[model samples]
Target: MSPNRALQRNISFYDATNPQEALGGVVQNGSITEANFLDILGILLVVDGVSPLRAQGRMSNHIVSRRDVPLKTGVYNIYCDASIQISNEPWIQRLVSRFAYREKDTFRREISNRDRKCVISGIVNPESSIQAGNWAGFKAAHIFPLEREGHWIQYDYGRWITDMDDAPRSSKISSSQNGILLLAHVHQVFQQYLISVNPDDGYKVVVFDLDRFGLDGKILDPLCRSPDDPHHASDELLRWHFRQSVLANMRGAGEPIFEHDFPPETDMVGEILAGHYGQERFDLDITDRLR
Candidate 1:
C-alpha cells in the first residue's frame, strides 16, 4: 500500500477464496472518520486515509442518496446519486499485490472500448465525469465463469465451457470474446441471466421476466452494434450464458416460471406511451391503466 492511498484513491480488493463475495465491505454509508473506518478492512490492509478530498469526491460522485452525515466536512457536502462504485485515481496503486487481476484487466478494457457505457442506461458520462486519469465504472463479466464452487475449471459449470457438445467452445474460455461489459447493476442482473441477448437476431436483448428479477427491459445494445468493432462476444459463450440462465430460473417442475419477454405489440404500446409522456419509463403498463 502507498503512504497516502485512502487520501487519493478508491481501491477495491478481493477475497481471493471467493471473488464473487469480494469488496462487500466497501463502506456505502458515505464517508466516516478515519478512526471509525479503521477496523473494518482485512487484516493485510492498512486503512488510515479518509481525508477531506477523498470523502468529498466519494460523496459528490459515488453516493446514491443523501442521508445523515457521520463525518463532519465544514466546507463541502458529499451527496451521491448513483450506486456507489470505485473509480480510478492516481492514489490507487495499493492492493494485495497478488490480486492485481482484480483491477480492470486488458480483457475488460478491450470490452469497454467496444461497448462504451452501459448499453441500457444510455448515459455517456460517469457520475463524477470520466477524468482523463480515472478508470471507468463498468465491469467486465465473463459469460463462462472462471471460478465455481471455490474451484477453477474442474466442476460441472467448468464442464459447460470445456465440454459442451452442441455449442462450439472457445479455446480461450476466459478471454474478452467470452465477456460482456456492463454497468454494475446491469452486471448483477446479467449475472443471473435476467438480461440476455438473442444469438439469432443482431444480438438484441431478450430479458426474461423483468418483474421477477426486479429489472425492467430496456433497449440494450449488443457488443457488436458498430460497423468496424473488431471484437465481439462469441456465440458459444452467449449460448452457454443463456442456457445457464434457463437452468437458474427453471422451476422445480423443470420449466421456466416466466416467459422471455413482452410481445412486440406490448413493446409498441410502451413506445407510444414513452413518446406521449416525453419520458421513457420501463414499466408503463397498458393493462394496468386500461386507457
Candidate 2:
C-alpha cells in the first residue's frame, strides 16, 4: 500500500519512416508536421523526466509491433515499428495526495465544492462532513483509484503497469480536472462500478473496478445504464454498472476480486503522516502566522 509501489514512468519509441508508422505510433494517420513532432517530444520530455534514458542509436525498443500505413492514391506501406514509453509521475501524486498530510483533506474539500455531489456517487449526503467520520469527512474519490498494498500507504498503478508490461499508456491520478468528490457510500459504489463520472456532463468512462458488489447496489449488469444524470441514470453509468456486475461474476474463476480501504475511510494518510512526522508533532496546536 506504500506509494513506493505505485510510482511508474517510461519512454517509448516509434518509427517515422512511413505514414503507417505514424498511425501506429499514435493511432492517427497524417503527414507528420512540426507541431506533431513537438507534441511527441513534449510527451517524451515527461517520460524522460520520470524514466531512465537509454541510447538506442537506431536499435528498436520493441515496445509495439508492425502496423499499416496508408497513403493517398492507393498507396500503402509498413516500414516502421510502433513502441510506447511510460512513466509514473501522475500516479505518484495520486498516492501522495491519498496518503499525504493535509493534502488529502484539502483536495477533498476542493473537489466537493466543485460538483457538490460525492465524486463516487451522484448523491450528496447532508450528513457528510469532515468532522463526522474519522476526520469528519465525506470521501473524495479518485477518478482513477490507488489500489492498496502491504501497509496501506499509497501504491502507484503506473509503476505496476510499467513493471508488469512496458506500455505507453500511463496511469492518470491527479490533474484536478480528472477527479471527483462523493459521499462515502457513493464513493464505495463508484469503486464498485469500476467507473467514475463527470458531474457537469455524465460521460461513460471505464475504470478497473476491483470490487464484488457494485456501487448502485447489486452485481453489475452490462445491460444496465450508467450512473450519470442523477435525473435519469445515464447510459454511460449503466454500461459501467453492467460491466462491473459481470466482472464480479467469479463463480468459476480462481482470482477473486480483492478488497482494500480507500481514502477518507482508511487511516492511510494519518498513518503515513504520523509515521513521518511523529504523532506528537502531528497533534501539535498552532496559531495564526501573520501577527
Candidate 3:
C-alpha cells in the first residue's frame, strides 16, 4: 500500500528532545535502535492509527541500514514504551501530531477541552447550539493558519522562529498557550482587528483588540472581563508568527463584527449567534457522529 509512508510522521531526530519536535529527520540513517524503533512504531500506531507491525515494516530498510538487529517485534516493544509515555501526557504530542497531519478536527477538540466556553461573552450553551451542532462554543482556529503561513520551527529567546522550511510544514498545528477559544464571530472579528487596528503588529490575533471590542465589537474595553483570564494578554511569539505569514489585504471592508455580549454570559457559538440570549450551559445531547 505504497509502504503506508503517508501514515508516518515527518519528525527529525535532531529535535527529538521535545515531544512536539519534527519527526522527518529523526529516523536517522533510515534507522533507529531496535528499542527506539519499536517505540516509534508504537507511537505511529497509537497516534496515527497505523498498525504496529505495518508501521515498523515501513521502516525496514531504514532500521536495517542503521542498526545491527532491526526486527519488527523488537521495534514493536520500543513503540509500546513510547506510546505509554506519550499517552500519560498527550496534549503536546497530540498537538504536534495533529499539526503535522493538518488534522483540523483534532485541533478544535483539544482547544475545546481546555477552555470550553467563549470568554468574550462568558455564556456556555449546549454543544448542539454552539457550531450548528458541532460543540457548544468550539471552533478550530489557526494560531498560524495554513491559509496564511503560520508555522514555526523553534524558539529564539521564548519566541518561535520560522526558519525551518522543511520543518515548517510539520508544525502547522502546534498549540501555543497564546492561542485562544472564541466564538466563530469573535474569531472573525479578531482577524479583522488584526488588519485594521494592529496592522503594525502583523496579522496575528491579539487579546488587546478583542478585549477592546468586547464580544459584540461595540468598541467597549475588551478586557472588561476578568483581566486575570490567562487569555487576556498578547502573545509576542504568535504575533511574530503572524507577521511572518499574514499578508495584509488592504481590500474591501471585512465582515461585520459581533460587538456585544450584552447578556454577559455566553459560549463561543452563542457569541456568534444573535437574538434574545440567556445564561445556561445546555447538555448539547449531540450524537457521537456530531462529536
Best by lDDT: 1
Report RMSD for candidate 2.
Answer: 16.8
| Rank by lDDT (best first) | 1, 3, 2
Please write out the lDDT profile of model 1 over residues 160-226, one tens digit for every residue. Answer: 3322344433334455556666776566566545566545334545444323432333344654344
Give the candidate number with the greatest TM-score: 1
Sort by TM-score, best first: what order?
1, 3, 2
Q: List model 3 lDDT by residue over 1-291, tens digit each.
A: 001211222332211233343232221222224444443333322343432332223334243223434333211112222332222211110011111223256556655655556544454546565456456434444444332222132322223322223433445334423344566655554443332122222221223122334332222123312246543323443444333212211011111222333344645345423321212111111111133
RMSD of each: 23.2, 16.8, 21.2
Q: How high is the lDDT of residue 194 in model 3?
A: 35
Error of 3 at 278 (Å): 43
**How many residue pairs clash in all the candidates, one count each?**
1, 42, 30
Q: For candidate 3, give the lDDT.
A: 0.32
lDDT of each: 0.39, 0.31, 0.32
- Give stretches of model 2 more than 4 Å off: 1-103, 119-121, 125-137, 147-172, 192-255, 259-291
Error of 3 at 73 (Å): 71
lDDT of 2 by residue, 7-83 (tens): 11011133234233222122111222223323333332233234332222134322221222211111112222333
Better of 1 and 3 by TM-score: 1
Give candidate 3 misplaced runs (Cα > 4 Å).
1-103, 126-137, 150-169, 176-178, 194-234, 238-291
